[model samples]
Target chain A: MPVTAVLHTETRVVRRLTTDFPALIAPDETAVDVTGLDINLSGGFTVLELDNSLRPASPEEALESGVDEAAAGARRKTRHRAASVALGAAAADPLSHTSLREALTKLRLAMYGE
Target chain B: MGLSVKTGSFVTETATGSKAYTGLGFQPKVLLLWSVGGVTAGTFRTGAYTSVGFGTDSTHRAALGWSSQNGQNFSNCARTQGPNVLDLVQWDVTTHIRADLVSMDSDGFTLNYTTVNATAKIVHYLAIGGSDITSCTVLDWPCGVATGNKVVTGVGFQPDAVMHLSIGEPSSGSSLQADARLSFGMMEAGGGQWSNVIYSVDNSGTSDSQRHQQTGKCIQKLTTTPSVNMAAQFVSMDSDGFTVNFTSVTGVAERVFSLCLKGGSHSLGSFSAITSGGPAQDSPSLGLAPLTYLLSSFNSSGQASPIGSTRWSLGGSDGTSEETAWANDTDALGTSASDTLSKTDKAIVICSATPAVLGEADHSALGSDVFTLTWSTVPVTAHELLYWAIGAGAAPAARIPRWLPVMRTHDPRPLDAVA
Candidate 1:
């Protein structure tokens, strides 16, 4: 099952339980199925707050959420860097180039309202 | 049966209700729980607290819990009723806002709370499971009763280890009071004893002073103001329970709670060395491989300028997983703090999750029965370090003697050829 919401309580932060664990595992919800393997919940896990969810969060969901947050931050930084580069180029050789002047006008229109 | 130990954490339920924590493959015979500090709603008391319970069922178990608050003055409260995990703002045990272990079930355990409206906090627990756990009991001793050795029996079996905690709510309020003393000590058979005690005096609730004493004695009460001197020294681990000698004749009837653990493969001992910020050195052998171990250190000089410092770490494997906490009082300031990173450099650290964070020492257990410790940074003022270790693992097989068979003279068997 996929984890929907991370429960942030006053005491601890809870996400979803996963098979793999880091060296220091924060305690989580109890009871793990021990059908085929000898491992138990003692390996350490995170708690996922659900109305009735029991299964753990899948790998794909974890990866997708991690990548989504990283990519979103990168995209925002990239746009800010592009705007700074354009402004720098116009300031350097604005009087000599007609293309640069036209580009600055378009850039200004995109950045500002009118 | 062999021993199995598991560590985990959980958050107490907020609403009025009970919760059972499962997933422990086997039923635990003994459970040790502590309050791991975290952000919480409402005015929660911030400090350290611990509780230990032993039993297979609810009615037959025994538990003792105590908490220490290092605020205006060091205030401590203890309860003898099952293992109760108190919420924040609960310095008084009379309040119904607490979590108590109700029963030890087949898989995990259950906790019943007084009210659901109390603030929740993170609790870390270590549970031990095995048939070798023959006896898990608690003993209470009235301090300053007499000035002689008192043997504590009725444990049924010699305990492998014991934990001591002083019970009573000693506070700092309107009057100049001198009752609050919080001490935590653990000792393992064949190993060393380590304990940290903090004694504070509330003078008119305005001016307060705390004495952080690190001594071999698990339960010690010594103060200059109001002239109170007493120490409950752990004499030895005996055939049944143990023995404690009281060194004072008169003092408050402060009670001491002890949790005795018998069974399992445990090695307990202490070593002494000077701090020079050196390489990793192997500790004296424990004679058997250990899966996990706890290391504790204190100044050998007893109480002084850095009045009795106590530092300890829990470590496992290539020393990668480790947790360290320390409490020390700088006599000049008359202030003491535990789990604080700034004052760690003054003392030596054996092992830490973040070695750089402590910047004193780091420790890792070797594959064999011994572990290695290294001091990352030399102390500004060098002092003797008394390190105590308690290692737990599978019990080793008993040794069998080899006897030489008698050879008849007529047989003419060579001495070297005897089987």
Candidate 2:
């Protein structure tokens, strides 16, 4: 019989549910107005103004703000270190297909924290 | 998923004037490319799988649509291999897309396409509204002539559009000749919009046409009599000058009187004495000397203030010695020579009298120098009656008998003492 480690370590999986997705687009046909948002989300997530009062934080936002303090800081440092490594790899081997993909993936992981 | 595949940038050019695109190995999706003078390149794509080529002989090009042949790989389908024609190419895709091609070399060129819609031509004039005509060679239309309002349909090099003008009744009391200056011009009916074309109808000088000459009734006959009797008298015998004292009535100040011999029938020199008396004689004389000199200074309101004193010499060299003597006496007595005497000689004597008194004398036969002495004296003052000595000599001098009340009698008095 294989012994399974039944030790329950707390692993937080924060989920933010958003049903009104179209509201992510600006109501005005022209450029978006994001002055109300405290955090800029256009880099990755499409920030939405769903209702006047309710604005739940997204998954990306939770990961950014909800991690354990020391671990969260380590993760941030690790992400910055990974981005710098990927940029060095891209510069060294720009034409190498493998290096390009690896660098792009690292960059995405750093931004989205996958 | 088995294999998701995408294909790209396959270009083909045709030979000069070759209208049909024939065999290229695999029926790869076709995109036509054209280059003009190695400078410009244009591409056109035929949606999915298709092939294009130029016919060896025919001018019309062909775009062949292909469905996959059984068991055929994408490579096996015909593909346009290299470049095509080296000259201009034109094609019509469906109905609306029309394109023209120019080929520079084996590798480059441009395709120009135009989409067109059908339209009709509209004609326009230089001056849409009308043109203003200042003068014209022919004065066919005159101003103020009214024509029935109509749309300004068209205009010509010369003013066209037949116009019916109402010349209105010929200027009142004027003869209507064919050649008169009949005013005629186009005008919008109802609205007083005048036409830009105005002209005068003159009968080109050959015809007898009269221009409008303004005539009016002789200025209302001014039968003005001196408000007070004129101080000067008309004398026919002596030809001695006289003094005229003109006192204007309140409203009569505006009246201007010109003194000239009436018909040129008689010879009388210009005015010698023109003095203005006051409102009433007792009010004092507003003497107007050299009336001609002061005519311009008369106030526009017609107020006759004292201009200055004026005197007429009765017995100067222009008169006989007796007249001269009379004028001297008159000057001494502070009386006008014209007021007291008829014959120049006695006029001198009477005018010279101290405390000049009225005189009586026969003045009937004083020949051609017949004169009428007229004047208004001071309102309430006592005046001695005076007369003229009729004969030439100074022998029998005449005197006026009674005291004449001022402003009363129009008779002449002499300077001789009464019996």
The CAPRI quality class of candidate 1 comes to incorrect
Best by lDDT: 1
True contacts kept of each: 0.00, 0.00
Write model 1 residue lDDT over B130-222, tens digit each, in one string: 666767766655554444576877666688777776533222111111223345666656434555554432211222224333444555543
Model 1 quality (TM-score): 0.54
The candidate scoring highest on TM-score is 1
Number of the top candidate by DockQ? 1
How far is each candidate from the true structure, as Cα RMSD in Å?
24.4, 56.2
Could you tell me the interface RMSD of model 2? Answer: 54.4
lDDT tens digits, residue span B1-419, model 2: 11111111112222223123222222211122211111111111111121112111112122111111111111011111111211111111121122232222222223333322231111000000001121111111111111111122112112211111111222221111110011111111111111110111111111111111000100010100101110111111111211111110111111111111100011111111112321111111111110000000000111111111111111211111121111110111111111112232222111212223222111122222222221222212221221211111111122221111212322224222211
Model 1: per-residue Cα lDDT at residue A85: 75
- The alpha-carbon lDDT assigned to residue B137 of candidate 1 equals 68
